[model samples]
Target: MKKYIQSYLGLHLIFLIIAMILFLPLLLNGELVTWRDSQFHIARFHELIMAQQNGHFFPDIIKYSGTNSWGYGLNFFYPTYLFYPLIFLWRLTKLPVTSILIFDIIVVYFALWSNFAIVYKITSKIKLAFTFALTYVLTAAIGNAILDNVAVVRIAYMTQYASNIVILLAPVVVLSFYNIIFLHDNRTWLRAAIYSSFAVMLSIPTTLGIVLTVLCMVVVAYFKRQLSINNMNQLLRSVLLTLGLSAAFVFPFIEQRLANNWANLPNNPDLFGANFSTVLMRIFNLSNVLSLLIIGLTALLIFYKKFNYVYKILGLSYIVALLFLYSNLFPWYLFNRELSGALQMTYRWHFMPAILGSLFVAFAVTDLMKIKQKMLPIVSVMLIYLSFNGMMLNTVAKIAMLMVLIMQRTILLHLTRIILKPIHCLA
Candidate 1:
């Protein structure tokens, strides 16, 4: 255990430094960075606190806009389970707005850790695991979607926490299936069922995601012939049990929504959403150069000989899934009109790419270690150009940050050697 601790101490140190560089410096600058929905979310937090004060420990609905005559509440359509614990903590401690900012930061970092766990399960390489985790957090897609100036962004009002929390919980679902389907771990059923229930508690957007992801995994396993009828039966039983476990929220919520159906929502979608790109990109225009790099990297892995066949399939499938969603090839949105309404935006499943794409990138990026050292500079420049093209910085500024990061890592490693060497000598 001591040897194991020493082996990964450097990596943990690097993760801390990286996380600090990304969030701490900007967050500590004493300015709250928020988007349009920030005030609404802050208001929601206050209302939840008020509800707790009124002896309603779990608030079913909160008055919107603070007037009973014009009140609107989202509880029937959305679940706030993800934020309950944090709200309770705030209720007890009475922390300030900075606490909220810190909460967002912690959620994004947890997402990076989640990405790492998923990739590590697939590749089982520590470096690749850390690299993919870092990629998931810092990638322009995730950065734009999840954060604003190091704070989690205001996307879904009170449910902004859902975006990051769901990303963080995604791997647990995948890992659960992998255990039950591939490893045949009997103990994993309890875990799978619980994770499924917790996932459902996250709300409709995530509930849809859970159902889709589980279905996808089941299909993949069926194709691979790794699943028998009994295995499928077991998976279905767990999922059904989750629905039962989730009834406290799900049943009441669904009944309320059905009984009081919004008059504004129509039965027919336009077949294509009004905001086409918004449905897909969610207000962020991904750099074409970056897109190509993502595609190119995925293709390299698809053809790469060293990776497991399963990984290659999974990676390619992820890319294909993105392409379908990004384009109009699939009618999943039109088919699931109610889900589209629940998501309230395009790219409802944006978290999918952030989770699976990291695994794919980890598989592809690890092979770079085998490349000749002389071409390292060229590869480094290419990576910087591809990944950060969306940032809109001048070329020089982009290259400068890349060079600085490289230099900082090098210096940190040298200092780590010096620091640990003295400790080692004493021990």
Candidate 2:
């Protein structure tokens, strides 16, 4: 028991140390880096707290009589889900905004850690798990999206911060799903419920993606005969519990908002109008660069029949996501606009498949290494080095590190065969 505890602590310590180092640049500049969306989220949180202090249970929307009677807006309501915990902390210790910013970093770190641990448990390979976790958290796309719109341009709004929180929670969602599906542990059912509920409360956009993924997993499990009666009962109960808990907070605001005209609510058009050619181009563009290496690797694994049942299920989920991306109905768009009204944006929907594709690739690479006798350690080292360097540096440095990763993978295969022949004979 002591040994197990020690092992867990050792692993967590390593993850924390690496995560902190990777996030150091952002931590140093995060306070100064104020995006409009982030500012909006912070403002909303402050507004809610102020309203609470004034003995109001809900945020009072200020309306100008005989002018713009825009009705009571729920813009301030979004952050309440994230702010409640912070408010508790603030009540215990009267810290300023700086403390909240620090708290955000800590929360993000734990989110990343939980995400990586979940991936590791699935793949049972430390190197691949670490690589996927690091990449997911610090992906160039995420950085580009955040830095381009939020940090440099000073767009302070709720979406930016909310998206970050969503990204952090994504792993938790995936992990919970993995636990319930593959491990079949009863504890995982409760965990999945809690995590999924928190995910929905954090950002409806991310939660929408997660729901679709869950649906796909459920369908696949049912078809594959993997869903036992016990598992099905657990899943249903968990979903019900999550919904009931969330409704306690969500129903009042939803009722209030829906009392106003739901049809004429804000609509986002950017999600629609992407033609087949454009969708193909986007997929191709991701593939041309090494960005979609994981996607390619997943395909290769499926082709070779190397993937296990669990991996096959995840792989099918990715395929379903792709099909949805191309479908005429644009289910993601409909779901997003329906749930959050003006809050749903189209371009961000790609994040769902991107994460799943990366996980698939990680699994494929690890499985490939297992089959190829001698290349495992070499490729593992390369991934570790690249993950560290990639996290610490910016564009040019990251590019160089990625190139090194590719070259190492190529050379290690040949080196493995040559080195293992003599050792095999001696053995």
Candidate 3:
């Protein structure tokens, strides 16, 4: 029991340390950085704080704090329950900016923990789990949410979209689903439903993304002959419960749509085109090391034969489906036209790839570390150089530098084995 407690504390301490390292710039600067949607998030946060202070516990109308105090029923349309933690901190600190910063740290730490938990559950290797978790967190997918310091030059911000919630809870949802289906653990079905409900509450697009991911895993499992009658039954139960638990948001969301006049709706052909273009650009761009690493390793995992069933199903096939959905190849035009109200933007699909891609990259790295080939050291060095280059070029300097240092230590240790091999051979 003491050993268990010590191990748990040590693992979480590492997660906390890494999260703080990622946030070092913002913490030192003592200010919240805005990018793309952050300003809108800040506005909504202010409105919530105002509403709470005014004694309207459940605000029906968002007080337009900046203008003539007009009210809009945004809370009815969008879920703000996920931000309650930040709100609680805001109430305690009475410092909105500090509240956001603290909230970001909390999100990052949990995200790391979730990623670590998923990887560790699969591999049962502490070192591999930590490495994969760290790599997963450093990717551009997650950087879009919490890594939006002044140092990061990318159009990074996901608060209004609540991708941070996706980042924190997606892995948990995936892990629970994995347990239910692959492990045949009926106990995890409810856990999967609960986490999936929270994910959908934050973003319906997240719900779609997770469902698609689970479908991919389900397909892979079926093909592998690992899926069974019990697995299918458990999956059905979990999905049903997920829908039931999410009814709170789903019912109102549907009612609002049904009651409202639908004569006019959003039409953005250019935005649809831009989404495809953005995915291509982000993938090909040399500065985006995280995306490139994910893309590269995902391709490798799909082709690489050595990865176990979990890595192949969870990492390879899932990522392929996600990238396919994100690509121009997917019939986004027809899909969007049919269900225009369902998704605000198509790029929301990137959430899953950013997440699952990280898992695959960790899988690739872990497998590479296990190989006995001496040339592996040279390969590791090249990867380190490219990763370092990506970090420096992309302006995620401080966080990247810390990650690079850790990678360097690991790679250099492997390189030393190569260096000593000649000496031992000579002896």
Candidates in order, TM-scores: namely 0.68, 0.67, 0.71
| Tens-place lDDT digits, model 2, residues 1-427 | 1232236676576556644554455556554344445554555556656667777654535322221133454432232555577776765666535456555556645755776677666656675765566455544133233322111111111345655566556766766775777567656666677777776676665577677777878888888888888888888988998888777666765776777643332445554434565444334443122245555665766677875786777667655554465444455554554554544444344456557666765566667766654333443344335444433333544354456567667889889989999999999
Error of 2 at 171 (Å): 3.9
lDDT of 3 by residue, 178-281 (tens): 77777776666776787788887676655676787788789888888999898888888888888898786677656665665433224455444335555554
Summed over model 1, clashes come to 2
Which RMSD values do the candidates have, in order? Answer: 14.2, 11.3, 11.0
Which sequence of candidate numbers ranks them by lDDT, best first? 3, 2, 1
> lDDT score, residue 233, model 3?
88
Q: Candidate 2, TM-score vs. the true structure?
A: 0.67
Give residue 86's error in model 2 in angstroms.
3.5
Score each candidate by Cα lDDT: 0.54, 0.55, 0.60
Model 2 alpha-carbon miss at residue 221, Å = 3.7
RMSD of 2: 11.3
Best by TM-score: 3
Clashing pairs in 2: 35-155, 35-156, 36-155, 36-156, 36-157, 37-155, 37-156, 37-157, 38-157
| Order of models, best TM-score first | 3, 1, 2
Give the Cα-based TM-score of candidate 3 against the true structure: 0.71
Indicate which candidate wins on lDDT.
Answer: 3
lDDT of 1 by residue, 88-157 (tens): 6676667645566556555655555655555455556766666566545544243333322111222112
